[model samples]
Target: MLRDLAGAEWPRRAGLAALAAALGAENIRWVGGAVRDGLLGVAAHDVDCATTLRPEDVIAACKRAGLRTAPTGIEHGTVTVILKDGPVEVTTLRRDVATDGRRATIAFASDWSEDAARRDFTINALYAHPETLAIADYFGGLDDLREGRVRFIGDARQRIAEDHLRILRYYRFQTRFGAALDEAAETACADLAHTLKGLSRERIAAELLALLALPDPHPTIARMRERGVLGVILPEACPAQVAALARLIAAESAQGFAPDPIRRLAALLPPSPDVAETVAARLRLSKAQRTRLVNAAERTAHDSANAKALAYRLTPPLAIDRLLLEGADARGLDRWAVPQFPLKGGAIVARGVTAGPSVARLLQAVEARWVGEGFPQGERIEALLAEELAKRPQP
Candidate 1:
């Protein structure tokens, strides 16, 4: 039971206890990730609460209870309250009045069934009565949870039509549930994948990142590919990425590792950093994430081209991403010495070379000569440079 769910986290429990004391059984429990994780024996990350109180009332009561409150998603009747113990997000029950596959216009609904019906998945529709621990499943979410099944809260197609992002979420839960996916859910996803065109690029990016961030992204992505969403979003990849991902997963399995989503995303890329960066931009990855993945992809491409070149081209984090990419590809990557590119723009500029493309070309030539000389001593570098400069035609 998740709706108004209490976590095993002691601070969370204390907050729930205080909430029950403050509301005196008026709280309808919560219905989100916390309950799902608790049921799965996984640690909960975020907790959400559902209540009979309107958003304003939730804000006021939170103030009375001495918790800081903020409008995080008030447009959708959600408010975030800062408990001395931890932050809690509470939202009022609501029913979707209309949806055009990108966004929903909702109306406040006092009935739990109406709220439950509006939920995207059955596993999300269950609720617990804080006082009784009595789980409510107007949509058989508990049964689905037990069956390791991910089912839509109502008609699968209707639920997906409410939010195109739910198409991605349906597959995300595939890795979470470890269950046989419901056929109806898959069909709905296929039916609604085209509707994702209506969704904002930023929203699509966040959803995609979240999906990629999951511990087991490959399987879910495989499902997405099977459903045609993958090709539409990323035409670069084939099943090779999945094979590479499996090797990465197998090698890391015993480490009990937590993954870096950005690096993992690079492993999913084709040989092109341009393509990866473009996809990152389309999803509106934070500038930092976009930069990180782009760098990671670049390092991977270079390392794939030449193991020795990688050390010269990439720094530590990017090098790590590069090796991981190779490992994911089931390619061997042994370390090699990487000589520095030994030419400086300032030094080249001081050599009677003006600051323009010529200087850049001179630097490239110097570096190429240094590499060609088997990375010889400084005098050897000077000799080659002098020889090249003397042979150059006047520009």
Candidate 2:
């Protein structure tokens, strides 16, 4: 019984309105994330609806309404209807007919209750009538949402059996919503933790990154490690690093730093190139991400590297990642304050040097000294540049 949903305003959006008009107000309702977020007063990023109409019927209805439709996942009974405002995804009500702990073979169903029953979490199984704005809670999702509880709908073990990725998702949602874990859910997750191996690296990586994106996700991650769920997929993961991550996260919040999942992930692993590479391969991370992770590991391992020099060499983002991973005080790592090298190739050439490898070598030597002297300026930099020129062998 949700009241006054005008604050959500999503149901009034042109896309949803057109979708509702085409599918009939009673036959379609906002479902899944949109509905859950709406009831919680959080702005939803995507609007997904569940409808009694089948996929073909949905496409035809959208066409009749003069809305462009895309078969985003037609086999799965999902259509992306593009309206004046945005695209609203409408999925026909579905029930899992078979499952193998990783993938589910779903069959379209007309019964809302049957559709709700197949969902993983109660808090996510909510539905909202488009026009009336009345919420449909097939399970006790309303109570769970109000109480900050994350529970598997119906049976915990059965849900886990249906999809092992829910183990990671359980922690992710817990952290996101600030909800306490359901005891049965936790127990089921721990008992069936090995099933996570059957899941693809991409799924695990996506879920893990989402978990790390939450504010102060360290506590939940620590709990996952304790339950041996982290090790099930990332055997090389070091639980000890999460302690460092906790301190870094505190500093990040205090200094108004945005959340960084890659850096946070670095804090959870050992600082080894081989390990970083292996993890990247396992997770199928993009090339740029893999390079940054490996570079952070290598740079942080250099105990003698000055933080400023590191920032200059590895670029500020990579250097900061390294600094945080190695337990450097975030207060001291003012990367933006790192001074730029006062000399360039042109500066060296202006000092009576020809434009060749000789100029390049001279600039490299001077810049090395500048960085070595903590990026000196004025008289100090001039003196160093002069001395290097004198030693240039009169080219």
Candidate 3:
């Protein structure tokens, strides 16, 4: 009985109305996450539309309406309609002509059911007319969504064989929406777990992080471990690390810190910087991501360091990561702006220290003392500089 997209604010947006009028409302229907999340009464962030119009025609129609359009994925039959509210992805209806687990060969179609059949999950196949807001459930998606079930649209094995990343996507959806795992879907994912090796590491990393980013993913992660799916993409994560993730989640809750996928990822690895670096490289994490993962894995005695000192030594965010992982207090640094050291290298050189390596060493010593002494300023900085200068040999 899913009749209308009641809570979905996107359809009411003026830009969407303009786009619909320009393209003829009958040709387009809101599809995918927008429809699914709208049914669940959750606010949808991205609005995707499936249309009978071809890509070039979509571009032409938008231009005729004086609306900006981008060929964001024109080859894949998608056109981006840039509205003032946000960019809406308008994709022509497509059916997969062929799939090889890595990529798909698609063919444009006029049938909505054909397009829905090509999707991975039943809940994702729901569509809604833009004007009337009537929902179209092609594969019992509304029922499955109401029942809190995450099931593939067709045969789970056949759907997963088309895209190995769906295995990870299944677990991610199950973690977020399912009250109980669909036994058949679970079995299919487990049986085809080895196929994940054929997919790109970047794809694997993206899915893994998305799963970790869930509100409470440790239980699902433990499930992933039991199926041996986690080992294929992330061999560094051991069974023991699942418990560590649970602990990290609890710490994050207790400390009122937001759930961080990268930090949670750090919890799933052995507390070794070398292992973190290896995992980061294997997953193709960005440079900043690699650094954060490695820093979180460092086996430092975070409990011993005061909040300010830790923040000064290893940055506020990284320090917060270490403190939370160790189950220590991180509230002291909350909204506390880290003060800069008052002394500079030039200031040290002005104190008769040579402008070479000695000045650098003197600056480091003073900075350390300043950090150790709680980042004192004004006259206290002058005193620290004098003490460091006294230790240095007179030129």
Q: lDDT winner among the candidates?
A: 3
Residue-wise C-alpha lDDT for candidate 3, range 343-371, written one tens digit per residue: 78888767666688888888888888888
Q: Which residue pairs does candidate 2 place in steric collision?
A: none
Clashing pairs in 3: none
- Counting clashing residue pairs in each candidate, in order, gives 10, 0, 0
**lDDT of each residue in 1-395, candidate 2, tens digit only:** 44356678677787677778888999898888877777778888788889999999999988888889999999989999887777788899999999998888999999999999999889899888888888899899988888788888989999999999999888888888745667898899999999998989899999988888888898888888888888887777675777867876876776566788888887777778888999999999999989987976675456336777777787777777776666564445553776767677887778778899988888788888888778878899788888988986653
- Those runs of model 3 whose alpha carbons end farther than 4 Å from true positions after fitting are 1-4, 302-304, 332-334, 345-358, 386-395
Model 3 TM-score on a 0 to 1 scale: 0.93
Candidate 1 residues 1-395, lDDT tens each? 32333344532467766766665565657566777666656677566788877898887776787767899999999988776567778888998888888778988889888888888888877676666656677877777887889988778887787788888788777777846868888887886788778778877766676777777777778778777887666656578875676656654453334566676667677657788778787777888777777876665343544443454545545555666666533123223445666657787667777889977877778777675556677677767667767767887
**lDDT (C-alpha, whole model) for all candidates:** 0.71, 0.82, 0.89
Model 1, residue 384: displacement in angstroms?
18
lDDT of 2: 0.82
By TM-score, the better pick of 2 and 3 is 3
By TM-score, the better pick of 1 and 2 is: 2
Query: How far off is residue 382 in model 3, in Å?
Result: 3.5
